[model samples]
Target chain A: MQSDLKRIVSKLHSGMRIAVPVDYAGVSMALTRPMIEAGLRDLDLVCVPTGGLQVDMLVGAGCVRSVETSAVSLGEAGGAPRFNAAVKEGSIKVIDATCPAVHAGLIAAQKGSPFLPLRGLIGTDVLANRPDWKVIDNPLSDQKDPVVLIPAIHPDVAIFHAPMADRHGNVWIGRRRELAPMAYAARETYVTVDRIVEGNLLADEMTGAGVLPALYVSAVAEAPKGAWPYGLWGEYPADVDELKRYAAAARTQEGFDAYMSETAQQGEPA
Target chain B: MSNVLPREILITTIARLLEGVRHVAVGASSPMPAAGAMLRRALDENERTVRLSILGSVEHNFFTNGSCELFDSAGQGRIDAFFLGGGQIDGQANVNLVGVGDYPQVKVRWPGSFGSAYLYFVVPKVILFREEHTPRVMVEKVDFVSAPGVSDPEVYRPGGPVALLTGKGLFSFDKTRPGFTLESTHEGESLASIREATGFAFEHADSVPETPAPDAATLELLRTRVLDELEETYPAFAADWRRDLAALSVPA
Candidate 1:
């Protein structure tokens, strides 16, 4: 079903497990800002924390109660002040995970498996914090070698902004194939796109292989300049100036609130 | 000119260490190592000889399957070298990327472990790079081990730490001995400072040499090509470091 920004925000409630694509995937912060501004609280957020803009925005708005991800930061921009502050204040539970573990958990859910066995976490503290994870001797190995297995992660909703989605809801994800597995692992997938193309994205030879079929997409919304501040790979580049401004403005709670208010006002439809 | 920036020194040392490697992958937030890897790629006359997959750079990265692809490639032995750092690193090279004080109730919280636990085992030449060499960072034992430096003899491991380069000095990780041994100190750094700053005990040679600064040719290439390429992924770091170099070059 085609939905508006307000309707999408209305669909989210307190304590829902939501997953977004990693920073490099070109996720638009626009899709998430409304939900946070609407006072969605106590969220179980999942994603490889890209640090500055996306995760920091949600955490700064106090929308997140817990975060399960690898790391969160602004990358070249600087530290994620709000997210770091929230963690230090003990207001949020940070599930310190590795990138592979996040992917493995999603893979398990995608495959309908109870858990997925992974390599390299055998002797690390990542396993220590996670009682849900278990290290057992690899039964498939000829010799004795223990491996860490992570439980499946099926999010309540998977949301992201993409380059384009055709009217038929075929998302042209291109090389960002993580969306496929993420959508498969979640109960439903919602998307915001920069534009809606006229024809089916799957019908075009160049974009056919990159299409995330309508089968997995529950809702599609058109939000131009959707991945602002963050770049939509191939379509545009990250707005470095805005990201720098965000890092500076978000260092304090009052400043963060003001910044959010300003953006929310500017982002509204006249 | 004798006057050289510390980052230049580090980039030079890292480039030398990366010699002969076919492929080197640098993680996000590692501008110095990323620059060093690009420098190595530039020095090679043979085109496409040294492949660098720098995370977050469009031109550098070639992965189609997103972040998970990095781990998959490392497991298949495609990556030759990688860089890792820690909130706490012990004598045995065990890195703690989780947090300090205790688990769940941490006194200090760092951004969670991205891939150190996994990459440390699979990537053959994992270089532990840390700019801060204080006791707080170089600890006796990390409260939590994010990735153990040395694995059991029977473990099927192809990758481990080769060397660790800090701001003050360089230390070699001997596989046979499986502990850090002081190799050399930076130009102005003394053995006393290195010892006092370090929390963990490490073996050192009777006579340690000074880490060589980047030669004039290397500096030129770094200033132009490496810095230019680094701007794409790490614009802030590249710009800031460039400004620092400019300030250092000014006559008093």
Candidate 2:
């Protein structure tokens, strides 16, 4: 169904594992707001560490029960207030991992494999903390060195914003290859695009190679500036001022509520 | 009389350390290292083949495959040098990029490990850069080993800690001895102060030399071309550094 933000988020239920692309990768921050505004709780949100305003917004709205990602930080913008606060208070479960682990897990699911073998994480704390990840000796090699294997992470829903999508629903991901793996791994894929193009993206020589086939996409919503406060690659730069303000205002619960209410009134995407 | 900033000293020293590297990749939130890499790229006209892949830069980075591309390249021995930092860096060069206190839950929390664990093993010349030179930061043992500085003899590790550059001094890692040896101290920083601040034990010469200052030509390039290019990815940091350089040369 090609639905709006509210309707798309309304479909989310508590305790669902939702995967979004990393901050640098296209993230639909606008669609996530309605889920927060709806007060949906106990979500298992997954993304890379550099999630900046996107993860902080959800954590600030108290929609996340656990975060299964490599890291969560604001990067150059400074500290991630809500995420830091939640971790400090022991209110959230952090499945701390390395970047490759998260990527391997998703890729494993995409390939329909039980697990994916990774090179590192042998003597590190990442291996110690994650019991699900195991080390096995490389059977094929003459020298038996241990290799860590991570279980497949098949998220319930994969949601993100993209620069463009054609009428056929083929989303153009450009260089963001992680989105391809994410959509393949998830049970359902939902996307919000800056604009829906006329010609089929797969047919165009320039954009064809970058298209994520419509067969993987379940829903497509049109939301301009959807990855706001976070840049959408070649489109526009991040709203740094808004990000800094968010970092400050999200330090406290009351302040977060005030910030969200004010933003909600700003008439974000329908 | 000329003036110098501690941070400027760091950049110059890092550039010197990065000499002869074909490709250096600077991760996000690392302006100083990125600046050092850029400076190296600018000064040495002979090494025009040097390639810098700054994570968030539009112009500097040539990678089309996004985040995982760096890791894949590093694994194949393409990226010669990379930078890593931690909340705590231990005696053996093991780093803790995760948190401070205990596992699962800690007293102090920093960002989680994204690629440090994997890249530390693949990249040949992984420089450990930590500006803070306190016992709290340079510890006896890291609380959590995000990526070990030294691995087991059996482990198939190509990349490990080469050197550590801090605000106080620079230490070269001895792979055979499996320890850090105090190389030299930054100008105006005393050996006594470094000894007092360092939590881990390291061998030092009777007389440690002062780190060489950046020549006039290099400094000029840093203030101009380096600063201009850096502003694209690190606007606030570049602006602040430019402002600081201006303030330093001002009449008292």
Question: Could you tell me the interface RMSD of model 1?
Answer: 1.8
Instruction: Name model 1 segments beyond 4 Å from true.
Output: A1-3, A49-52, A268-270, B1-3, B215-220, B235-252
Can you write out model 2's per-residue Cα lDDT over B87-128, one digit (the tens) per residue?
899989999987888766777678788788888888899999
- Per residue, candidate 1 scores C-alpha lDDT tens digits across B1-252 of 457888899998999999989889998778899999989988884755999998877788889887888888998999999999988999989998767886765777776678887899999999999999999999988988888898887666889899999999999998777789989999889889999999988899888889998878988999999999889878889889889888878987
TM-score of each: 0.93, 0.96
TM-score of chain A of each: 0.95, 0.95
Report lDDT per candidate.
Answer: 0.85, 0.85
